[model samples]
Target: MKSYDTIIIGAGMSGLAAGIRLAMFDKKVLILEKHTIAGGLNSFYARKGRKLDVGLHAMTNFAKKGERGKPLTKLLKQLRIPYSELALNEQHRSKVVFPNKELSFTNDLNIFTDEIISKFPHEKDGFMALLEDVRNFNEVSLENPYESAKERVSKFIDDECLREMIFCPLLIYGSAWEDDMDFSQFVIMFKSIFMEGFARPEGGVRRVITLLMKKYKELGGEIKFRSGVSEILTEDTKAKGVKLETGEVLLADKVLSSIGYPETVASIKEDLEVKPRVGKLSFTETILCYDKKPAELGIKDTIVFYNENDAYHYRKPKTLFDEKSAVVCLPNNFEIDDYSDGMIRLTFMANFDLWENLSEEEYKNEKNKVLEASKDIVRKLYPSIDMEPNFVDIFTPKTIKKFTSHHGGTVYGSIDKSRDGKTPVNGLYLIGTDQGFLGIVGAMLSGISMANLHCLMPAGAES
Candidate 1:
């Protein structure tokens, strides 16, 4: 049995961040991952010389300055990861196409406002008031407790199209809760994106994960892949160690779980005094096409959103693919030149309950259905590109569950953002998106916060 000061379960972003931070502080650390790679959802795969990112498309929160201050860049600096930014075309930062009309949201806030005004000239007052509401929500989010994005939208904007264009997509993109999530929480999410410009790492998100893993190893942190923890050994209501799938018992002073709360407790198989409420966990499903070049799709460092009138259709249980679709550009210069020849990645949120009980044959059939749906969306958005893709990669909620061990393959660890970021048991910590936020920056911040709290506690003080 191997022993360490800390054992981090799941080597996703949160786990890696925690391992890096703890190791840097001279605490012996070990990160155990069920998959061969370190990145959880952010990892990529190669098929027939084509590389496809599992879930990551374009990332936000990398802006140099924001209302809440510099996020991605600041976090990178603190982690000692060297990074450079890429420019997203202001003309087509995001294009929303509905049945009646299409609108483009630019990177510049003023341009975005002007474009909206031009489209809905008569509703100029409504548009300006909506922007003000967004600004006010950002300013007072940390203090207020509004309970639904829809409520906030109803209060600020009366135009259905404007509300659909903004809040509808925002709800679909951020959480699994169909447009009815807490308003304050939704506002904070929106503020992070508008106030902070979104950018992709020069080499890809995997580069960021790889650098953090390297730094963790440099600090004497150990990692064991394909070693899933089957049980958490406890005594007197405190975690003491873990038993791996291979029956190897490794003891640690503390265990930090980057996986979701339910999965962590399920693995431990113990009754805790406090149990977190389990809401719907959102899964990001994508079908990556390597058939066309970036320019062929009219994509130039920009993302495309195809608006669906029925965003609520996702609430009903469905397969890995849904009606709502978004396409992201992946340029050849960003990653490996060999496989990056001509790649465009398409992603959408999937309902976890839809694929929770599929057989092998059923799963493949459902996957094909998803691929077909993605093709339909692609044809509508990029008319120039061919419908058939040279290569396609499909990731369902089941695939996510197998790799990350998150309940229902939830990308985020928890849904309740109001609770203090803590588990019920002592010496146990929960980080990552499951708690309600998403993105690489948010995951890293959670890990950093947990690690900081742990470091402040004296050695052997809790265990």
Candidate 2:
């Protein structure tokens, strides 16, 4: 049995990033992925010769080449990836659409600030104050304790409508907690979304995965696709190695799991004294490929956070899905429209249990209904575009659970995050969603930070 320096569980963004970091320093690292592909939630699939991105609507925290102190810049710098490789296309604009109000924003913070001032003039001062608070707060601090984002924002913004509108995009995009998010997460989202804003890699999520995989492979990192880990071997309250489902045991001095915290804990044979609460949020997305692009139909927004009601309910739906609110993404609306066909993706919060309990036929019927509802939303958002989609595909929480192995089909993992990536078991760490970071950029950052802090620093010091 060959002993390795580190074994990373899951080939998701965090895992891939951790593997790359470890491998960069010549550490013998192996990444085990249950799926055939990488990217985890932010992955892609091909249907009828067309590639479709899964979780990536837009990559937040867009930065210009060599932009210092930015998340994107930091991530690329840490991973030794050049900014040019991303081929980022900035979003034309995105909106928060409420019942009687609409706020549009672009990559520029001025645009969002102006929109807020114009729409909610009274709350302008409060919004600015909130922005300052968000800017000043070190959201990435590992020692920071959890606080309700809603409560913290309430201190700045008094108008409930404005508050709901501001949080609509942020909450649905990244929050693991229902209704509200942790304050640190809120700040992270706020900076990434409103401050740095949105952009997409030229080839969607595939571009990102390809870049990561290329870098990781160049560093001599080893990864095994469809190599699902059955259990994490522990001895004397420390990680010894991992046992593959096929009964092969690989020994490692350290194990870093990009899988969610609870899932990692469950995989361990030892009954560790910890119960990381699984998050309640999940989603169902409908992808429609139309004959004409959104721009051709006079819809130029890159993404629209659509809410029919004044209050945004960001929680698990009692029904199959909550139709009142949705995230409508127009991939073609970016600066460079690389898609051959116009694509519109609509995401609605859904209940995993409701979808999970359905029989095969019932599941199919429910998915059809969801597809119809998504079309209805498109119609309502843009009445001028009245044409049947050339192709339509819908994915539910069940699909997320099947592909990602995330509990509750959750896009974001457990609400209880391990900020420092430390687990109860020695030599084991958590990265990705449950590591308290948000979005793709955050996930990669989590992996890099954890790998540096827990793995590399000690090795370098010892050497």
Candidate 1, residue 382: how far the Cα is off, in Å: 2.1
Candidate 1, 1-463: lDDT as tens digits:
7788889888888788878888888888899888888888778766675555676655665454332345565566556665543222122365556767666654456756777789878778876776677666543223455466776667767777766666544555566454466775566556555445345554566667767878899988899998888988887777788999999999998888876777777776677865654546555465555555665556654556565663334352454555564544443423233344566566566777778777889888888887777777766666776656766777777788777766766654445552234566667666666544457767777677667666546766523
Report model 2's TM-score to 2 decimal places: 0.98
TM-score, candidate number 1: 0.85
Q: Which parts of model 1 are misplaced by more than 4 Å?
A: 65-68, 85-92, 121-146, 277-291, 297-301, 310-320, 324-339, 417-419, 457-463
Give the local distance difference test score of model 1: 0.65
Local accuracy of candidate 2 as per-residue lDDT tens digits, 1-463: 8689999999989999999999999999999999999988889999999998987899999999989999899999999998999999999999999999999999999999999999999998999899889989999888888999999999999999999998999999999888998899899999899999999999999999999999999999999998999999999889999999889999999999988988999999888899999888999999999889888878899999999987999989889999999999999999999999999999999999999999999999999999999999999999988999999999999999999999889889998888989899989999888988868999999999999999998555522
Global lDDT of each model?
Answer: 0.65, 0.92
The per-residue C-alpha lDDT of model 2 at residue 288 equals 95
